[model samples]
Target: MFKIMIVEDDPKIREIVLENITKWGFDGLGVEDFSEVFNTFIKYEPHLILMDINLPSFDGFYWCNKIREVSKVPIIFVSSRNTNMDIIMAVNMGGDDFIQKPFSLEVLMAKMNAILRRTYSYTSVESNIIEHNGAALNLKDSTIIYNEHKLELTKNEFKIIYLLMKNNGGVVSRDKIMRSLWEDESFVDDNTLTVNINRLRKKLADIGLDNFIQTKKGQGYIIL
Candidate 1:
């Protein structure tokens, strides 16, 4: 089933939306730890998201920008803020659509269905091997081949490597990385990500790819 992640903070709205969406026959995931909205998203691997504008620590715009960094998951902003500027900014910040609060259930369901169809209706299957800089990632086999060396990878490892390699020479921030690793559950603590990344790097080192992924200090990580 195609999953949809909802990031609304208000429990009433969150519950209502979840009920409405599920009643429409699509699976829906409610964000538990508001702090790890993106993290939950990566784990759920949702096909779309329903985001609220005002959040506890960060606004939906900030989260939307973060999600756009590594994914094109369809985001539909759902907020009580109904200014034209708010809607415009939502769109500019990578929201695919915006639904104002006090909206009809039918309208919300319609928008959800439309966005899902539009996003996935045209997605083609990825090729087994994606290559660059003499490196090849076999999607079918979950391995990275480079310089006649084959580096085996777990699914998460392959995805992390795929994202970094795809955005070669560019820093992929921890927020983005954590989203990829644990988008399904509660917040992914910083130390948790640190541990996984360290483990992933050691695995790469085992396969002779020492320092293939570099730390970016106050920023994120990169494949340099």
Candidate 2:
């Protein structure tokens, strides 16, 4: 099943979209921690993202720009603020489609399916094996390889590590990281991210990848 990320703030809307997505045979993930949108995005690496315009802390446009920097993933804007300016801004921010709220779920699914087919379904994955140094990530199977030692990762863990490796040698901002983790960046607790990162680091160390990840004080992390 294709994985999809939903970034709506309203519980009802989030559920509605997820239901439709699931009905279309796509696995859906709703952002639990809005405060860490980018982190969740990378951690989950959803095939497509559904975003709301008006969000706490930073809006959808802000998060969209962040995601665009790391991946060519498709983003569909879903918002109640359906002004011409908003729609135009959504496109300018790299959204593939603008979906105004109070719309039919069927139409939404259609748009989503079309985007997925054009962007990924018609194209094979990039060998699924994303490698660096002695470490490699099997995108096809979602696995990791390091020094001939295999490491099985949860979907969240794999996405986190993949984004870090993709942006190696550069400090990826915390906001950027959060977006990958959760759709609503306003709801994520700082401790939650800390715990996940700490756990990932420990796992890497277990595989002899000590210090493979470096932290920049007040910034984010990088794979140096």
Candidate 3:
């Protein structure tokens, strides 16, 4: 079942939303600690987030930006604010959709279902997670996690990691990596591949996982 996280401050509203989500055959996780919402978010790893604008320690905008840095998990702002600027800001800050306050539960469910369908229906694969050496990469969204530090990666970077991790403990040649990337999508030359590998290595190092990916000299790269 898909996991949905509700981050509303109002207890009554939060409960009501969760109840509806449960009734609809989804697993719903309600936020218990407002001050540590990010920690809770990392723990739950919900497929979708229902965020409120007026949070306790930090507003939804702040949390949205934070989450965007690490994830592309679909976030829909559930706020009382209906101003044009609020909606625009929410979208700009990585929120997938926004619902105004006092909305009917039915309407909310409809929107949620629409977003869920639109998000997952296009994919042929059911599972998108790839894990190696305590690092997990979400192929669907290009998000990576290691030792609780999350990072969003570019398309080429994601492909590179996916290839290496899939062949963990095995060497993947540079030419093979280039062939895996789309030729028409972008012109990935030898230098471009090296740049992506270096950037990925730096990102991994920032998360306390230095040298996670190893070089095999002329052979290629490996994650041993």
Candidate 4:
């Protein structure tokens, strides 16, 4: 089932939204810890989000930007502020839709359905993901997910991981990695590939995935 995360602080509004979500046969994850919306988001991995413009600690715009850094999950802004500027900001922050306050649940559901359909309808099964030992590389966002922990990666870092994960059980040579990242490696610095690999390994380590990308001395790297 698709999960919908609600980031509104008001208890009444949160309950109402969740009720409607349940009625529509979708799971609703209400955020209680506003101080760590991103943490809660990582835990839920919601397919869609209902975010309020006004939030504790940080505003929805800030959280929206953070989420966009790693995910393309659909976000719909629900706020009382209906000014043109607010709506524009919502769009700019990667919100799929903006629903004015005091909206009927029907309207909210309609918007959610429309956005969900549009976002997921044309999704092809040619998976844009590569996985090894529970570490998943999202090709579309250039991020990694390991044990529910996510890390956004740089372009070179992503290419490195992609090459390793694509050849999961086999040791990919450093030369092959450089070639995959840049068509021509002669112009690249000798240590650039090592630097990128080290960075990617550190990121993987941060998410409880230590030694995920195993080094084979002079053989290159492998995700065993």
TM-score of each: 0.59, 0.59, 0.61, 0.65
lDDT of 4 by residue, 97-167 (tens): 99999899989999899988887788832445666766667788888876557788988888888887788
lDDT of each: 0.79, 0.80, 0.84, 0.85
Model 2 bad stretches (over 4 Å): 126-210, 213-224
Per-residue lDDT of candidate 2, residues 35-113 (tens digit): 7787676667688999998888889999899766556788999998988999999999899999888888889888988
**Which segments of candidate 1 are over 4 A away from where they belong?**
124-224
Best by TM-score: 4
What's the CA error at residue 20 for candidate 3, in Å?
1.0
Q: Which residue window of length 10 is worst by lDDT in model 4?
A: 124-133
Q: In candidate 3, which residue ranges exceed 4 Å CA deviation? A: 124-224
Comparing 1 and 4 by lDDT, which wins? Answer: 4
- 37-142: candidate 3 lDDT, tens digit per residue: 7767766778889999998878999988977766777899999999999999999999998999998999999988898898878863244566675677777678
Cα displacement (angstroms), candidate 1, residue 141, comes to: 18
TM-score, candidate number 1: 0.59
Instruction: Put the candidates in lDDT order, highest first.
Output: 4, 3, 2, 1
